[model samples]
Target: MAPTHSDHHHHNDGKKPPPKLLTLPTILTIGRVAAVPLLVATFYVDSWWGPNATTVIFLAAAITDWLDGYLARKMKQGTAFGAFLDPVADKLMVAATLVLLCTKPFEAGVFGQAPWLLTVPAITIIGREITMSAVREWAASQDGKLSEAIAVNNLGKWKTATQMTALTILLATRDGSLIGEGTLLASGVVLLYISAWLSAWSLVVYMRKIWKVLLM
Candidate 1:
């Protein structure tokens, strides 16, 4: 028997809506991920414009990071996919930039022949990111209280700000032309260490919050 018009309408109404995957926030998050390869390609350019280009790309991605979150809240376009993709994009860009910084002209130019200076903070920041990501995943699988306890805090914000600034300065000074090598590079290194410290501190705070749940 053929269904009546009213029955068809009711059937459509009862079905679950599809996930919103192409919203503006998700698009911006995807753009951030797309920028990663471009950022890396700049490292091989070996021209006066290379470092500047890398800086611009990194800065643009960083701006989009904030812009997407703001728009997501203001426009009510947030999605589960966006929430997941956003941090993955940020971590990819940061990890890639840090790895590149420890290579080539940057290794000697930015760190003054001491790769460990950059290496230590780079490893710390990356390790913290990895560990926290795992913790968040584990928390998500448990009771709701675990997730709440491990939510983002102000310290994470400060760490991101400091880390982004440090990377931008280091990228711009790769060839040492933007604002002289010594002072700017030193400033970047200092900020990076501070960022790493913040990362570790925040990780410890998160673990302390969830330790009881894990012990069970």
Candidate 2:
């Protein structure tokens, strides 16, 4: 019989295995976390790049969020640490960007003339993230699978999609870099509210699933 691919694996019998924390996927995940500081620095650069640079950097970092997971699964490089850190990286990106836009008071308001519009959506999204993280952490400390049950769902993914897109657009508007009409800021604000709605929906779903467990 011909030698099979698996049969060739015996050649590495003497080698030490690499550390779990050093995998390529995990490295990419770490890069995403590091990008947050870079993003913040770009905001204060005081140059032509301004929010334009942030938009590009933020978009790249956001893409890494999906790319890291895809590479992890495709390369079979997933680790326990990678699983834990990936979502933490994601939450950090979203929360930091939203807080930057909402509190910085860009031109009187971050996205709109109405003070509460941007504030409400930012708070909604941020609050839901913090709450869900606490809930999932507590659930994991109890029953391991309990957290997985309420883990990232379709709605949660949609919330991230909308949230990332909205923030990207909102930031772009700050430097007068709108892709279309002058109403891009307003559009971003509207999408932010939509994302927040989805954020709230996902939180409610997670809480309902674990409410009984939490009561005990």
RMSD per model, one decimal: 3.5, 5.5
**Model 1 lDDT tens row, 81-196:** 99899999999999999999877535445446674788899999999999988888889998998998888889999999999999998888778676567788888889999999
- TM-scores, all candidates, are 0.88, 0.84
Q: Write the per-residue lDDT of candidate 2 for residues 1-216, one digit (tens) a residue.
A: 998765566556635455568788899889989999998999877798878888898898889888989999999989999999999998898888887886665553333456566788888988988888787778878776577667678997788888989998888888764556357776787888899999999889888778755565
Tell me the whole-model lDDT of each prediction, alpha carbons only.
Answer: 0.89, 0.81
Count clashing residue pairs in model 2: 0
Worst 10 residues of 1 by lDDT: 104-113
Q: Compared to the true structure, candidate 2 yields what TM-score? A: 0.84
Candidate 1: segments with Cα more than 4 A from true spot: 1-7, 10-19, 105-112, 212-216
- Candidate 1 is scored at a TM of 0.88
